[model samples]
Target: MSPVCLIARDEWRALLRNRAGLLASGLLVLLVLVASFTSLERRAAIEADRERYQASVDEQFDQQPDRHPHRMVHYGQFVFRPIAPLAFFDTGVDSYTGNTIFLEGHRQNSANFAEARQSSLLMRFGQLTPAFVLQTLAPLLLIFLGFASISRERERGTLRLMAAQGVAARQVMLGKLLAHGVIALIIGLPAFLVLSGFAATGAAGWATVLPMIAGYAAWLLLWAVLSVVVSGLFHRSRDALAILIGVWMVGVILLPRVLPVMAEQRTQLDTNIETEIALHRKLADIGDSHDPEDPYFNDFREQVLDEYGVESIEDLPVQYAGLVSIEGERLTTGIYADSAARSSARENAQNALVHDFSIISPLIAIRQLSMTLAGSDLASHYDFLQQTEAFRYNFVQRLNRMQAELIPGIGGEDPRISAEYWQEIPRFHYQAPSPFSRPSDLIWPAAVLLGWLVALSALAAWASNRLERNLR
Candidate 1:
């Protein structure tokens, strides 16, 4: 047998004989199983709740009492962003972003019910998902299992004995790495299986599932290589374990939280209240539709008369007041959209700053990658907002157009368009972006994770060379 193969077998045997190692590995496998089950259940519950709410809201829109189109605009529609199918595996920034949005004419509302606002600070610790398990907990488990792989051998003078017996140091290091890499794979198995099961069952697509698997595999292997390198470099097993744990805490736990806070602090976005006030101010600056003598309306009235070749609004083919209302709504909606775009830009800037730290911490990269793939990231939220805005504009304008065309034909002191027009208005249906359609968002994070894997592999190779020199 090859020296590397013999060394690998002996190391595997030693790992099996270590009762504590077996127990730790067993516990991690169990934890992964538990996390998978809970995550799947949690996702199902959230999906059902959101679906139920959506149905209720749709019903409410359909059952509205007879009212003016403008009144209905004030009543507004409620849009609920659906939870992505694979969100169960990695909730990512879902908890931080608001899920419910109120859509009305002339104003843009912030998403109202963010999970962060509802939950306790304990949420900041992190949610229990496959991503969380693999990113945060799996590394610690790998370190515990393998931190003593070479350090313990050196401490007990077994490394020297192995070297004297014609086993090369490189072979010994490679053997330990192979054994523990298998252990890391085992630790990550249950989560991977759950993710695969989700894909198999059609809850997630292969596009998302494959990239997630690859990213997580890279993450775990990076930690495995890191563990072996640290163990080989350190003279004492205890020092190896302590150093590895410290690194895990800082990289996995501390940085994800701190970077977000810094990002928010650096890019201070306007509060929703401030945004709404600004929008209202902009709208008021434009002439009011209700005032017949308003300058903007006067000019608009002349324009309408010229188009129709009529001297007075009443002589025209359409209702003059309704045309003015439509024009007014157009102006207000335009301002609202501009304000919304500005706010979205600010939020993107904050997220971009956080993404910049992905290079320093792969956890941020993986978290961003997971969320983006799952369709629960900020970009998805923005898409929902933009779609809802479009729907609101369409619904409002259709009603206004009804008043313009229908009210004039039905002429009266207070012309009322048939309530049946409401039935003809189309309902809002949200269309989520497909996984493959959004590759740019996922690319940077994947690149960061792969970079970490390459860097750590190089470090491991360097550490092995040093171990070879010391043994000779």
Candidate 2:
């Protein structure tokens, strides 16, 4: 073995000989394992309950007695977003964001029954999962173990002894980095195996899962290198420990919460009530189809008459009221869709502003990456909302089409469709699009993480050089 490798081995032996280091490492690994098993169990229970609820809703809708198509539209359907397999490892924003969306005609509902909303305030502190452990706690464990990688030796005159024994200063630094880096890998291995076990069960796609493993591995290494460099920067291990803890508090706890608030303040989106009120005003301006003398409806009625090759509404084959209902629905849907688009745009801008500061905190990058890879990000939830909206439009319009064709032309207010027709409308089946479909979503945050890795590597090299100068 090379001198650096020999030194690295000795450093590892020293850490192993330290009982406090061993206890801390053991406690962290135990915490990770328990968190993994508990989180997985929680996810499974949630998935089962959601599936049961969805099945019940589907059965109830299909079994409803023959009713007016418009009534059915107003009755609405409850659609559940499927839980992603990787979510067990990283709950992401899933708990905070609701999974059940109510799809009714004329209005869009927010996803409801969010766990965070229902749970005690402690939920906001973040859930117990592998991602949480590694992102928030593993770094602390590493800091505790490695803060003295160099400073302890420097304090005891061991550095001079090593130099007299012909060990280069940079070699000693590289040895410390390697020793801590290996410990980091050892710390992360259990979580990695947990993910692999998830992959083995075919619960998650290997495409995303493998990259998730890489991302987390990189995350841990980032902290490992960071801690080692901080050790080199400080002459005392206590000083190094204090600084690393401050960094942990700021990046892991403070900034994630603060940045989102700042981003929201900077790019505020309209609230649901405000959007609805605005929509009502816009719909009123479009002119009511029910008013006989309203120019908009008169023109629409004339156009319908022209299309049907008839001189009056009474002479038309289809119900005129049904046609008007269809037109009204189109108008409202258009406005609602525009408002939804605007709200989504503003929310996305806010998220972008927060993500732009990935340089300031790699935790932002890792949290985003884990959520994206796990398929529980805000984008995925929004995808579900968009799909539900489209399905709602199609199902409601189909009902309207039935009313137009089957109802009496003049008096179709109480027209009913066959109960079988409800079954034909199709239950909401989520496509669960591949995480890779939006590569760009994962790419930038990943690039930021990569940038952190590169910057840390540079910092390590600089620290090594500084160690050499101090030795001279």
Candidate 3:
């Protein structure tokens, strides 16, 4: 066997002899399995419940008794965002961002019933998903296994003995990296297998699942290189362990938590109440439709009259009030669109700030890549909101059109449209944006992870050179 292979085999045998380390590895694998099965079950239950509720609500909307078309506008529709198949592997921000939206006329309601709002503070720590296991816990396990890789050899004088026996320092470093990198890949195997299962079932595509596996594999390999390099730099195994633990704590845990707060402070997003107040103020700037003498409505009325070749509102074939409702809806929808854009921009800016600092903390990078691939990121939620808004506009306009054309000739104060018209209204069906819809979102985070691996490789080279000099 080659020197590197021999060294790696010895290291593996040592790991097997250490009962505590062996047990820890077994437990981590078990945790991945438990998290995988439970997450799949949980995702299935939530999806089934949402599907049932959606069908029930859609049925109820169709069965409504005969009523004024305008009355149906107020009744509204509820649309639930369907969970993506890969979301079972990584819930991402789905737990915090609500998945259902209530669509009504003249008002844009925010998504509600998020678990974060209802659950305790402990929820912020994160759920036990496959992504969580690979991203957070897997690195710590690599540190434990490899922190003593080279330092223990130096402490016992085996490194010098190897040098005298013609073992090159580069060979030792490569051997250590080979052993730990293979172990890192092994640690991540369960998660990758889970993802492959999702792809095989047609819940997720191999195109997306392949890249997700690559990003996470890069993440684990980065930690493995860091652990072995740090071990080589220190003269004592305890010193290596202390330094690795501190680095893990800061990069994996502290930076992720702190950077979000910093991002929020730097780019302030409007609160719900503040956004509502701004929307109302903007609406006020446009004259009310209820006022007959209001300049905005008067101008709108004249336009409608001109289009139909009628000089007066009453001379028009369509019901004047229904026309007014349609015009009012158009004006309000413009304001809502502006508000939604501003809100989306602010939230994206906050995320961008966090992403910019991903170099120092790779957790953020992997997280962005993982969530984006899984279709459970902030962008996905925003896409859902936009889809709902478009649906709302189309449905409301259909009702307004019905009111204008069908109600004018009817003579009663409470003129009613046929109940059959309600049955014809289409139900909202959301189509999730493709994961690659924005190429930059996927590219940047994946680049960050690969960059970490490159830098660590350079560091490993430097550590190996230093070890050679020390032995001389």
- Best by the lDDT measure: 3
lDDT of each: 0.81, 0.86, 0.91
Full-model lDDT, candidate 1:
0.81
Q: What is the C-alpha lDDT profile of model 2 across 365-403, one tens digit per residue?
A: 998889999988888888888898899888778877777
Q: How do the residues 1-472 of candidate 1 rate in per-residue lDDT, one tens digit apiece?
A: 8887777788789889989888877877787788778978887887789888988987787777656666676777787888888877777667877888887766667677878788888876777776777888788888887889899899999999988998887788788878877777777777788888888998788877888888788888878888888999999999999999998888888888898899889999988688767877888789787565688787788888999999887698877777887898888888877877887888889989988988988888887887888787878878887888888888877777777777766765655555565666787778998756777778889899889888977787888889989988
lDDT per residue as tens, model 3, 29-87: 99999999999999999999999999999999999998999889999999988899999
The reply for model 1, stretches above 4 Å from the true place, is 290-292
**Candidate 3 deviant stretches above 4 angstroms:** 290-295
Q: Which ten residues in a row have the lowest lDDT in candidate 3?
A: 287-296
What is candidate 1's TM-score against the reference?
0.94
TM-score of predicted structure 2: 0.96
